[model samples]
Each structure stands twice: as structure tokens, then as C-alpha cells.
Target: MNFEEIKSDENNYLMHTYGRFNAALVSGKGAKAVDVNGKEYIDFTSGIGVNSLGYCDDGWVKAVTEQAGKIQHMSNLYYSPVQIETAKKLCELSGADKVLFCNSGAEANECAIKIARKYSFDKYGDGRNKILTLVNSFHGRTVTTLAATGQEVFHNFFFPFTEGFVYAQANDTDDFKAHIDESVCAVLIELIQGEGGVVPLEPEFVKTVADVCAEKDILLMVDEVQTGVSRTGQFLCCQNYGIKPNVITLAKGLAGGLPIGACLCSKELANVFTPGTHGTTFGGNPIACAAALEVLNRVSTDEFLNEVRQKGKYIIEKLSTFPNVKKTRSAGMLIGILTEKDNAKEVAAKCVERGLLVLTAKNLIRLLPPLTITYEEIDKGLEILKSVMEE
Candidate 1:
């Protein structure tokens, strides 16, 4: 169908939840996409970091296709070898003892919250179920995860949010300490606040939080929904900080482009979730698990991770040279460019007009290019971005 027809049909049938772009992408390959009108675009956003291996990745397709032919899905009541294999790979790579699969980042985070609260209640009883999260953090859109998010903006329109959540200033050790007490069961954080404008927490502050959580026996939960699965040039972003979180939530790039979420727990909290305590219908769908297995195999490698780091560095350096760029902040392929003028959204629209797809996060232009993007694609995207910024 044509772009206008698709838009009209969507407006008639679908709820207006997203403020969508004008482009109607019909097909894509690697880091390039084509609109219905045959306009080509460099896809730097990578479907908001979901298409980790870019469009139609050969290995990812093969795994998913093979699994679909065998068994698309099996009830959790029955054992699934593919699911078990995916879990094994996740545990082996992430240093987590066990994993509980779900269908999205929000569900993964919800599971983490449940495990943390239940673990505390199981041992210390009630009153210690409160979870502290850093300010400006974005967890998920679910009522429970929405409350878990620290941003006040997301708190509105949803009344009587889930209780037992408190906010602490990010990277402020004193502020974090002031909010901590016996009532706190866990401290959830994102090492790199992706939706919060790609902000990276201070290493010292992270270490202090980890130390305090250890001293108080509070569970330290890292929300890696955006930064995990080699997006940050490591198997997990916590590895760069040299700290081990009791629980870590992952999604987005985990299954290349498929829907899958995982809540991985350390040995201490591994058995916290009993069989009947938690579950999901599509938690470990065989096809999704097969795609995730392929993603893990390709990304959890020293060579691939190093290339991601180098590509990130190259993009950062090139962005810094742009005249309109005020500053650049990033960790691997997850990047944010602050413009000298507060026109991030306008600039992003202009980029799309000029055959490049970018995203706007607050006042910064965000980029999450494919991890396997070639240098030529990066150069092309950068050229388009520079041209738009120069205008």
C-alpha cells in the first residue's frame, strides 16, 4: 500500500499512542532502508536498538526459520530444548546463575521487581519491599514498571501507581544514602541512562552504590534493557564498571529483532523465583529463543565486541568535529549528541528528510546504529547528519 493509504488506515484502526515519523519504511537490508516511495535512508536508530544485527541478518534468519519449521511454540508446561539452550548461553555469558524469560523489557523488569520484593519478604518479611531507583531513569510503560521509573513526567495520567518505590538522585552518593534504610529491599539503576539522554553514571558513584548495597545486604539491580546484549561493547555494561549486580534485566537487542525478555539473577537470588511463584505464556517461545541464541553466539565474542567499541569511537570522534555539535556522550553504539542549539527534534526531522533516520532524546540527537553496520554505512549516515546540522 501507499504511504498515505497506510497512514489513513492506521488512523482509522489503530490507537494514536505513538508520535510517529512520516516515513513508511517498506524494506531494508543491513543499515539501509527503503520507504514506500523508494527513498533510501540510513537507519541509525536500528528500530530503537532492536535490530542489533540490522535488517534480515542471515544467521538470525536461519536460526529463526529453522526453529519455526520445527516448533514455533510450546507451552511452558512442557520442556523446550531451545529454551533451555538459550538460558544456558545467557547464564554462561552473563555470569548469572538462572534466567526467567518474558516477552519485553517491561516484563523483565517486572519480574526483577517481584524477585527482589519477594526475596526480601521471604526472609525479612514486610516493610522491606521498597525499591529505590535513580532519578531520570525509565523502566517501562507498565503500571508497575512506570512507578519503578524515577521520572516524574511518566507518573502522571496513571493514578495510584504501585507503591514501595522511592527516587534517589543519580550519581549522588549522599543523596542515595539519605534515601536508603531498612525499608529498602533493592536499588535499581541503569549504568547508562539511554532514554534519559544517554547519560553515563560516574564510576565512583556506581562503586559506592554497589558497596553500600553489599554492606546493607540490599539487592543491587541493573536495568540493562537498552545497554545489554553487547550494545555497550560488553556482554553487560556492569562489566565495564567492574561490579556484579544481584539481578539484571535484558531485552531489545537480545533476540536480534524478535520479542524476548530475560531477568537474570546471581547465585544469591537465583532460586528466589519458585516454579509456581512466576510465569508467562510466551516467556520462552522456541522461535524467539532460537533467534536469541543466534544473537548471543554472534555478539558474545571478543572480536565483535571490540569492533563495536571501535565503531562507537569513530562515530563519537566524527560527531565531535561537526560545527553544530556541542558535545557527545556515549558508551559503544549507544550515543547522544548535544547540539549547540536546542533543536534536536527539528534536526532529527530534517535528517529524515535528507535520507537518514535518527532519534531525539530530550534535547539531544540519539543514535543506536546496528552493531554490524559497516564503516561505509556509518560514513554515509554521518554525512547526512552533518549536512542537516550545517543547515
Candidate 2:
């Protein structure tokens, strides 16, 4: 079908949740996508950071295809080697004790919330379940996760959001401390606020929070959903902070474009969920695990990670030279181009029209190009972006 037909069907049949761009991508490989009309685009968004290895990655496709051919899915009651291997790899790489697989970033964060509450309840009995999240931080879209999100905008529409969540200003040590008390069980944070703006939390503030959480025995949960799996030039963004969180939530590029989310907890909180306490039907499906394994095999390497850091630097340097760019906030491939005119939304739309896919966070032009995107692809995308900014 043509783009118009697809758009008509989408508008008529589907809910109008997303204000989608005017394009119908049909196929892609390595930082490039082709529309139904055969117009090619340099993919800077990478499906919002889900395509870590770029479109149709050879190894990732092979692993997922082979696993689907064998067993697409199985109940959690049954043990699968692929699932075990994926968990093991995650634990080994992130230094977490155990992992609970899920289907999306929201589910993974929900798991973390449950674990934090359970751990606190198991030890302190009750009334110590309030979680503190930074303001302007985006957790997920579910009821509980939405409640956990610190943005007041999300608090609306969802009537009476799940209780036990409090907001603290990001990078404000005093504000975070003021919110913390005997009732607080956990402090969930994103080292680099992705959806909020690609803004990195201050190193000193992070250190202070870590120290306070440790001293008070409050669980420190890092939501690496958008920054994990080498997107931030490290296995986990928390690693860059030189601190190990009590709980870590991962998704997005975990399976290199497949649906998979993982919540990893330290050894102390590993056994908080005892079988019936928590579960998901498709949590540990063999196919998703297989794809995750392939992603780990390729992304968790010094060579690949170094290249990611370099690419991020190069992108930032180029964006700095752009006429409309005022500044940039970046961690590895996750980048936000702050426009001088504060017209990121308009700039993003113009880029999409000119054959370059991009994203927007708040009012900044966000870019999460695939880690494996070539220099040539980067140049092409940036050229288009530069021209759009010039206009």
C-alpha cells in the first residue's frame, strides 16, 4: 500500500496516540531505511534507540530467526537454555546477581518497583514504601510507572495515580535529601535523563545520592532503559558514575530491535520475589532471549564500545558547528541538539521531510543513531540536518 493508504488506515483504525511522521518505512539495513516509494533515509533515531545494531543486523536476525524456527515462546514454568544464557550474560556484564525478564521498559521498571517495595517490606514491615524520583524524568507509560514518572504533565489524565511516589528535583542534592525519610524505600534515577532531555545528572550529585542511599539502606535503582546496552558507551550508564545500583532496569536496545526488558538486582535483593510473588507469561521467551544473547555478544566488547564513544564525540563536534545548534547534551550515541531558536520540534519535522529521521525530547532535537552506523551514514544524516537547520 501507498503511504497515504497506510496513513488513512492508521488514522481510521488505530488510536491517535502518536503524532507520527509522514513516512512509511518498508525495509532497512545499517543506518538506512527505504520507504514504500523507495526514498531512502539515514536513520538517526534507530527506532528510538531500539535498533542498536542498525536495521536488519545480520547476526541479530539470524539468532532471532533460528530461535523462532525452533521455539518462539514457552511458558515461564518451563526452563529454556536460551533464557538462562541471556540472564547469565546480563548478570555477568552488569554485575547484578539475578535478572527478571519482561516485555517492555515499563514492565522492567514495574518489576524494580515491586522488588524495592518487597525488599523494604520484608525487612522494615510496612509504611516504608515511598519511592523518590527526579522531576522531569520519564520512567514509563503504565499506571504505576506513570505515577513514578516525575513529570506533572503525565500525572494528569490518569486519575489518582498509584500512590507512594514523590518527586525530587534532578541534580539537586538538597531537594533529594529533603524528600528522603523513614518512609522512603527506594530512590529511582536515570544517570542520564533520556526522554526528559539527554541531560546527564551531575556526577557530584549522583555520588551524594549514592552515599545517602547506602547510609540509609534505601534501594538505589537506576533506570537504564534508554541508556543501557552500550548506548552510553558503557555496559550501563551507572558504570560511568562508578557506582553499582541496588536495582537496574534495562530495555530499548537490549535485544537489538526485539521486545525484551530486564530488571537486575544486587545479590542482597536477588531472592525478594519468590516464584508466586511476581511473574509474566512471556518474560523469558526463547526467541527474545536469543536475540538478546546476540546483542550482548557483539555490544559488550571493548572494541565496539570504544567506537561508540568516538562516534558520539564526532557527532557532538559536528552538531556544535551547525548554525542553529546552541549546545548539545550527549552520552555516547544518545544526543540532544538544543537549537538556538528553541525550535527543535520544527527542526525535527523539517529533517524528516528531507530524508533524515530524528526525535524530539521536550524541546530539543534528540538523536539516537544506531551504534553501528557508519561515518558515511552519519555524514549524510548530519548534512540533511545541517541544511534543515540553516533554513
Candidate 3:
């Protein structure tokens, strides 16, 4: 259908929740998408980092197609090769003792929160159910994960959010210390606050938090849902901090645009969940697992990771010189462009008009180009973004 047709039909049927953007994308090829009107766009958003290898990666498509033909899904009671293989790859990469699969970032984080609480419950009895999360952090939309998010705006309209969460200031050692109590069971953090304007947590702060968690015996959980699967130029963003977390949530790019979420825990928290403790029917479906396996195979390589780092540097270098950009911050391909002259939301919209897709995080223009994006495409996308910034 044409853009008008799609937009009209969508508005007629769909909920008006999102302030829908004007473009109606129809198809894409390797970091570039075309709208229904044939307007081409360099896709820096990558479906909000879900398309780790960009659109329609040949191998990923092949894996998904083959798996679908064989077995699309199987009940949790039955064993499936693809699911088992995906789990094996995740455990090997993350160094976590075991993993529990779910369907989205929210579910992954929900599972992590539960594991943290259950681990605490087995040891400390009651009252140690509180989870501390950093301020300006965004976890997920579920009630529990929403409660875990430290932002105030999301706390409203949903009365009586899950009550066991406490907020601590991000990177503020003093503020973090003040929020602690005997009831705290875990300290959840995002190494790089993706939704919070892509702010990287201070290394010293992470060290202190880790030390505190150890001293207090509170579980250290890292939310890598947006930063994992090689989005941050590493297998996991926590690797940059050189610290191991008790539990890490993984999603977004994990299943190559398919829905899959994994909550991995270290040896200590792994056994906290028994067979009947928790589960999900679609957690480890064969088709999603197959796509995820291919993504893992390609994204976890030495050469591919090195390229991601280089591309991140390349994008930042170009953005730093943009007319209105004040600066940029990031570790890898996850970039937050801080502009001095224009609102980031406006800049992102302008980029859409100029055939470039982008994202926004608070006042910063967020960019999550595919990990496999080439130098030529990066150059093209940057050129469009530069023009938008200057305009």
C-alpha cells in the first residue's frame, strides 16, 4: 500500500499512543530503508537496535527460514535443538551459569528482578525485597520493571507501581549510599544509560557499587537489554567496566529482529529458580532461537567487534564537527549527539525528511546504526545527518 493508505488504515485501526512519524516504511536493504513513496532513508535506528545485522541479513534469514520449515515452536516440556543451542551460545558468551528466556526487554528485566528477590528471600527471609535502581534509568514498561525505572514521569498514570523499588542518583556515590537500607535485595544498573541520553556510568562509580553490593551482600544486576548483543562494541557493556554482575538482562538485538529476551545469572543466582518457580511458553521457541543463534555467531566475532568500534569512532568524528552539535558521548556504535542550537527531537524529525532515520533520548539525538553497517553507508548517513544539523 501507499504511504497515505497505510497511514490512514493505521490511524483508523491502531491506538493513538505514539505521536506517529510521517513516514511509512515498506522495505529495506542493509542499513537503508525505503518508504512507500520510494523515499530512501539510511536507517541509523535499526529498529531501535533490534536489527543488529541490519535488514534481512542473508544468513539470518536463511537460519530463520530453515528453522521455520523444521519446527517453528515447541512446548517448554519438550526439548528443542535450536533453543538449547541458543542458550548454550548465550551462556558461553556472557559467562553466566544459566539463562531464562522470555519475550522482550521488559520480561527479561521482570525475570531478573524476580530472581534477585528470590535469591534474597531464600537467604534473608522477608523485608529484603527492595531493588535499588539508578535515577534517570529506564528498565521496561511492565509494572515491576516500570517501578524499577528511576524516572518520575513514568511513575504517574499507573497508580501504586510495584512498591519494592527505591531510586538512587546515577553516578552519585553519596546519593547512592544514602538510599540503601537493610531491606535492599539488589542494586540494578545500566553500564551506559541508553535511554537516559546515552550517559556512560563512571567507572569509579561502578566499582564502588560493585564493592557495596559485595559488602552488603546485595545482588548486582546489569540491564544490558539495550547495550548487549554487540551494540556497544562489546558482547556486553559490563565488559567495558571490567565487572561481573550477578544478573544481566539481554534483549533487543539478541534475536536479529525477532522477539527474544534472556535473563542470565551468575552461579549464585542461577539455582534460585527451580523448575516450577517460573517459566514462559514462548521463551525459547525454535525459530526465534535459530535467528538469535545466527546473530550470536556473527556478532561475537573478533573482526566484527573491531569494526563496530571503528564505525562508532567514525560516526562520532563526523558528528563532533556538525554545525550545532556540542559534543557526543558513547563507547561504541551507541551514540548520543548533544546539539547546542536545535532540539534533538527536531533534528531527528529533519533527518527523516532528509532520508535518514534516527532516535532521541531526552535532549540528545540517539543513534544506533547496525553493527554491520559499512563505511560507505556510514558516510552517507552522516552526510544526511550533517545537513539536518546545519539546517
What lDDT would each prediction earn against the true structure? 0.95, 0.94, 0.91
- In model 1, which range of ten residues has the least summed lDDT? 266-275
What clash pairs does model 3 have? Answer: none
Q: Which lDDT tens digits does candidate 2 get at residues 296-380?
A: 9999999999999999999999988889888899999999989999999898888888999999999899999999999999999
lDDT of 2 at 216: 98
lDDT computed for candidate 3:
0.91
> To one decimal, what is the Cα RMSD in angstroms of model 3 from the true structure?
0.9
The reply for model 2, stretches above 4 Å from the true place, is none
Give the 10-residue window scoring lowest on summed lDDT in candidate 2.
152-161
Models 1 onward score TM values of 0.99, 0.99, 0.98
What number of clashing residue pairs does each candidate have, in the order they appear? 0, 0, 0
lDDT for residue 95 in candidate 2, whole number 0-100 = 96
